[model samples]
Target chain A: MTGALAAAAGGGCHIFSGCGFPAPGLQDFIWTPFFTIGQFQFTKPMLLAILSALVVIGFFWAAFRKPKLIPGRTQSLGEMAILAVRDQILRPSLGRKGDSYLPFLVSLFFFIYIMNVMELIPVFQFPVTSRIGFVWPMVFTVYFLYLYLGFMHQGAWGYLRNMIPAGVPWPIYIILVPVELLRFFIFQPFTLGVRLFGNMFAGHLLLTIFTLATWYLLSLSVGLLYAVGSFALAIFVFVLETLVTLLQAFIFTTLTATYIASSVEPAH
Target chain B: MSVRDRSGRDTSVEAESRALGLNIGWTVFSYLLSGMAAYGLIGWLIGRAVRVEILFPVGMLVGLAISLGFVIWRFGKRGITREETSR
Candidate 1:
């Protein structure tokens, strides 16, 4: 999508020109594989996902490589980032007792945040999460962890029993039980992935549309005015995407912690 | 046990409430979705068997009502308990 839009803009696909508007669509998300190994096709989003992981690891390693009584600038930044996730996201759900899960949550938060932030960076304008494939594994891991923890702590039968709200009449349980089961086993994990994917996908598509429109509207005539408006809107959408990226990551990590907390402690 | 601002006012309560709000919002949405989907599918299956097409939409309405009733009972119970505690 990025390269295609750039080409169209450079090629002068203006409104005055007979050439139709090169509207961005799902094709924008479909990239030619950089290389192929057997049936596996390596693409830009895959590279971005790997690079996101490395960026997270490399930053933390540089920050905390040498233990220091007095922290350096990098360490301070590292501490600030981790503490933000811990204080704002993890603790609100899990409290002090769940401190052991801090490293996992921190990694998840930064990995997701950086992957999303990639959409804003030059030459890597695609959000990896917009590809639902990347999101599901993360969602499934959290789902598995919480379910495993639930069974481990509460016993399998007890865990199932705990999911049902107590004091509800026996007959109502027929309906209520299925609803609760669907909510926990299916809907929770499904929504977790869908929420992140939908936000990134829609945000990227919107930015693409406005940006392509800006280029397509550019002309010597009154079309230039519309082009300028489109350009401004493109900039606005770009700025909004930055906040959306972070907010989505926060929501994902917080929900992960919430699920874990629920598993460790039964529903009230 | 609670977080505090620079002025030393505890902010954990506010944070917890915000978290609760987020969870509740999602919970409500999921309940509505699950109810409609579950009952709607059942209705579709039964309607297909009986050759009555109206049951699909009817099923969805029934599901929505059941979910709404359950949610009200569930949270309304908590609300009543809180009121009693304050008294």
Candidate 2:
């Protein structure tokens, strides 16, 4: 997509010029590192990830630095962000008692939402979370916390015992126990990270394809209509990506809260 | 038929159910997948040992069936229990 766009901007490629359509693929995701120190390399996605974290931190710090009897606009915005996560994500899982985890959940939601939203931005058009390497750490954090909370609240043996759902027959336990344990330990966390990565990766690829198609099809003749159609599809995809960016973040945080709640209590 | 709190708001029940609904949705997927994976591996291994190539797919089917049974039992029990309480 980027190559096609650059070519189009340079007035280089058209249908009659014998240039084949450049289809976007996994190559679009692989970035040339900006710099490297020893084995460690920094890339655009890393920069965007750091910028997202800084943005979340700076916005909240600026908004709530001053104590207020009644909230001003910044403070009001900050409260709304907090309250949205709390009411929609946290309370649904942990109830009023989970207010203590509010800060962590709120930060997570914004951090992820911003990273996902980066794909829609002009220059930073890559979603940081599309890189699975960026996603696993967050997954491990949530998984670790879930296990930690389970062990803390329900002790080691009790937590292990809690993996077995209630009221199952004894003979069935032979089959069900292993399934439940594997589901809890492996599948849950695996799906959490992959779900985010898959959505962002697919969304980015779709946008790129339509965009590349738009540029590739643009001509003074019959292809102009096709270019317009491709452009329309790209716009439609962009709108959907915007919604998906937020939805993925919400689902991730909500599932994290759900895991924590199940750990602290017991599986139903 | 919403359950109310001491202050008469039913939001708590609503939120709890929403949470449970989300949990159940994921749990169902996990159950099916885990069952297939677990039994399928066992079936494949045994099949390999006994030189029965059919065991792998057979294992997956068994795993899937067990998972479905468990899901039906667990959620079905909950539905019955809820009906009893509501009555």
Evaluate fnat for each of the predicted models and list the values in order: 0.25, 0.31
Model 2 chain A: weakest 10-residue lDDT segment is A1-10
Residue pairs in collision within model 2: none
Q: Given candidate 1, what's the lDDT at residue A29? A: 85
User: Model 1: which docking level applies?
Assistant: acceptable
Q: What digit string (tens of lDDT, one per residue) describes model 2 on residues A95-168? A: 66777888999999999999999999998898999999999999999999989999998889888876776566
Query: Which residue pairs come into collision in candidate 1?
Result: none
lDDT by residue for model 1 over B1-87, one digit each (tens)?
A: 567555332248756665666666677788888888888888999999999999999988888888899888766656532111100
How well does candidate 1 match the true structure in TM-score terms?
Answer: 0.92
Which lDDT tens digits does candidate 1 get at residues A42-159?
Answer: 9999999999999999999999999587999999999999988878877777777778899999999999999999999988888999999999999999999999999998889888
What DockQ score does model 1 reach against the true complex? 0.29
Q: Under CAPRI classification, how is model 2 graded?
A: acceptable
